[model samples]
Target: MSPAKSRHLNPKKLIRSKWTSASPRNKEKHFIVTNIIQPESKDLPIDLIELEAVYSGRSFALSWRELTNTQDWLQGWR
Candidate 1:
């Protein structure tokens, strides 16, 4: 099998972005970037973000880099 195609993501522009899970569970396929977790130290880069499910209004924190893995996530609603 070929390698999964990954999406190019810019962490600075992730807020309010839309996404679709490749393998959705509990019918929570659509999601939006609700918030970007601020780093405790100014020198630290952004590493986490909050994703809110459109179907269930559930929110959770996740590594921003995980969105780059197209095998698990798509850039927009699909």
Candidate 2:
């Protein structure tokens, strides 16, 4: 099978964005971007983001870049 196309994402506008997992676990299929982790040094770029499960209220941190991987995440609720 061919690889999934990566989704376009603007890091600056990631906050409050919604997403859906392509393969969900724990019934946490829908999620929202709740936080953007800031770098300790002002010169550094954003790297991590916090995602909260809409169904379970659970949250976790992951690299923002991971969202670009279409195989794992979709841009909006699906």
Query: What is the Cα-based TM-score of model 1?
Result: 0.93
TM-score of each: 0.93, 0.93
- Candidate 1 lDDT over 22-61, as tens digits, reads 9999999999999999999989999999999999999999
- Candidate 2 wrong stretches, greater than 4 Å: none
Put down candidate 2 lDDT per residue, 2-72, tens digits, no spaces: 98788777777999999999999999999999999898998999999999999999999989999999999
Model 1: which residue pairs collide?
none
List the global CA lDDT of all models.
0.94, 0.93
